[model samples]
Target: MTTRLNPYLGFKDNAREAMTFYQTVFGGELALSTFGEFQASEDPAEKEKIMHGMLTTDSGLVLMGADTPNSMSYTPGDNYSVSLSGEDEGELRGFWEKLSGSGTVTVPLERAPWGDTFGMCTDGFGVAWLVNIAGAQQQEAQP
Candidate 1:
């Protein structure tokens, strides 16, 4: 088995909705486990909340998210951002449209200073994203 690094989002209470929305955007298999299902929480309210949710897209994108328990502190900030970079212009642009929909676009998707097309946006769930469409030369170099 190989180890991989993916984004693990921490939502206050909308892990299910947020993860589901991502499934629409990325077209993936979503597996969700609730606190009750995992027997991880005793409180009835927390039982229905998601303990862990994993979405594996066909494009090899893995996204994980979970609801934050009351016992834990959740501070939303600009500490982290999920980045999507590739040479597929159409595919990446489609992602940009879906991600930026109903969300705030900090940077429009267009030509960037470095010669690549790039953009930044925060989804409705308040998760920040950075999308970059690599130049022709960069794509050919990838294995």
Candidate 2:
């Protein structure tokens, strides 16, 4: 209903698995629809590929992703990483663990010189993510 900016990932053929994995880490409701669910595909193999999928977390995070149709060139890039920043250390840490479990951790989550816990990693599906836990001083309210 309102304007929102969120990550919409592109996968070669693993959109379902990747989205499901994200749901586990973010604790949310996931809705997925595939090409076959809507219309028959000329290519049998692609009929089941995801057309669109969305995950809305309890924390109000919304992430959408889909399998790149054969008609398009799905060039996976390292250009960006979905970032999560907040004062909730426990929640953010939990997400970091699950997200980096079967993936590569480019940066370990630890205290930073700027007084925050931060890390970056590429999920199993090749989607990058960054998580930051605000430090104690950051927990205070600001006018």
Candidate 3:
């Protein structure tokens, strides 16, 4: 396997639900492991919470996420952000809608100065995202 860069999200407590929703949106094989499965958490309440969750899409997208343990300090404003960029307008837009819904839109999706459609938002899990749709002329010019 070649080296790849992908987004790994961090959640307060809803890692499983967030990963499941992402699977529904991207259509992929989602492999998840809980704190109990790994014997990583001492708290019984956190046993079932996700320790690690990886979603590998058929489109070659890999997204990983985990629930933050209470033992550690977790602030909502920072940490992880995923950037989704490509020429697929319909697909990227669909993802933006699903990700931004019930969450906050830091930057509304719209046409950018680079001639591409772009937007930024933080998902319900507090994971930031950047979605970009390439320009039509750029596509046409590509041989």
Candidate 4:
């Protein structure tokens, strides 16, 4: 497998729900491990909470998430945005619709000034996303 960069989301308690919702949107295999299973938490209330969750899609998308332990400070969103960019209009648009429909579309997906279809949204899980289709990104000049 090739090394790739993907988003890892952190949730206070809804990591399982959020990750499962992402499976529906992206059509991926989701594997979740609970705190009890991992023996990571001694609190009974947190035993069932997700310790880690990974969603791997056939399209080479890996999205990971985990529930924040009670000891850690949890803040949702306003940190980073997961960006999806490619030339596949159909696939990218499908993702945008599902994601935006579930939450808020901060920027409508349309022709962007950068010569691509661009949009921004924050999913129900409080995760920000930027989607770009058929982008004409700057390329290096040939020698």
TM-score of each: 0.54, 0.52, 0.55, 0.53
Cα misplacement distance, residue 139 of candidate 4 (Å): 43
Output the number of the lDDT-best candidate: 3
Residue lDDT tens for model 1, 21-44: 999999989999898886767788
Model 2 per-residue lDDT tens digits across residues 25-132: 988999998878866356778898987688998788998778877875667783335767667666788889999997999879987655677787889998888776
Tens digit per residue, CA lDDT, model 3, 50-135: 97788988888888888988886577767576767667667778899999996999879987655677787989987778776778
Each candidate's lDDT (Cα)? Answer: 0.79, 0.77, 0.80, 0.77
The Cα error of candidate 4 at residue 67, in Å, is 0.7
Candidate 2 lDDT score relative to the true structure: 0.77
Please tell me which model should have the higher lDDT, number 1 or number 4. Answer: 1
How accurate locally is residue 84 in candidate 4, as Cα lDDT from 0 to 100? 74
Worst 10 residues of 2 by lDDT: 1-10
- What TM-score does prediction 3 earn? 0.55
Instruction: Give the 10-residue window scoring lowest on summed lDDT in candidate 3.
Output: 1-10
**Pick by TM-score: 2 or 3, better one:** 3
Clashing pairs for predicted structure model 1, backbone only: none
